[model samples]
Target: MKCPLCGCEKAHKHGKTSKGGQRYLCPHCKKTFTDTFDTIYYRRHLNTDEVHSILQSHTEGSSLRGISRITQRAYGTVVSLVRAASQKAQIVHNAKVQKIKTKEVIGNEMWSFVEKNKKPVSQKN
Candidate 1:
C-alpha cells in the first residue's frame, strides 16, 4: 500500500516484531510507517485490537485514565488518540450536516444537554 502521508508508492518491509507485526519504511519520506498510519493509533506502537479498544472506549465516553486501565496503555497515548479521533469525527459530522437538505435534520445531544441544564424545571405542588 502507498504511504498516505507522503503519497510514496515505494515502501520496504523493515522487519517483523515479536508480535508478528510488520513495519514499513517509506522511501520517499524516509519515515517509518505501519498499518496504523493515518489512523487513531499511528505512532502509538499498539496492535490493531488494542487500537480498536481505545477508540471504542473513547467513543463510549471513557476517560483517558479509564482507557489506560482497560487497554494497559499510557494515559497520554490514549488522550492523544482520542483527541485526534474526536477532531476527525467532528469534521466529518459537520460536513455531513452541511450536505443535508432543509427537510432532513440530525439531532445531537450538545444542544439538548445545554438547554436542559440551563434552567431548573419548577414542579407545582
Candidate 2:
C-alpha cells in the first residue's frame, strides 16, 4: 500500500516492533508508519481492534481500569479516552441547546460558572 502521508508508492516493510505491529518505510518521503496511520491511535502501539473493544467496553459502563485490563492498555490512557469522549458528548449536547427567551433575558453567568466547577461523578463510584 502507498504511504498515506505523502502518497508515496515506494514503500516497503521495514520490520515489526516489539509489540508485533508492522512497520513500513516510505523511500519517497523517508517516513515510517504502522497500520494505525490516519487514526486517533496512530502513534499508539495498541492494536486497532483492541482499542475499539476498549472503547466499546467504556460505552457499556465498564470501568476505565476494567477496559484497560481487557484491552491491555494503560489505565491512564483508557481513562483519558473515556473522559475525552464524555466531554465531547457534553459539548455536542450543549451545542444543540435552543435559545428560548422566556420572561425576557435572564443573567445566570454566576450559576453557569458554578456548574462549570461542579465535579463530574461517575455512576460506579
- All candidates' lDDT scores? 0.71, 0.70
Show the colliding residue pairs in model 2: none
Q: Point to the candidate with the largest lDDT.
A: 1
How many times do residue backbones clash in model 1?
0
RMSD of 1: 7.2
Give candidate 1 misplaced runs (Cα > 4 Å).
17-20, 61-75, 91-98, 109-125
The TM-scores, one per candidate, come to: 0.55, 0.49
Error (Å) of candidate 2 at residue 62 is 4.5
lDDT at position 98, candidate 1: 67
68-120 per-residue lDDT for model 2 (tens digits): 78777787787666555556656876898668658877653211111234677
Residue 44 displacement in candidate 1 (angstroms): 2.1
Candidate 2: list runs displaced more than 4 Å: 45-50, 62-75, 82-125
Number of the predicted model whose TM-score against the real structure is largest: 1
For residues 1-125, could you state the per-residue lDDT of candidate 1 as single tens digits? 68777888888898865556678888888887667666666555776788778887666777667888988888778767666777777888888856455876677542111112356678889
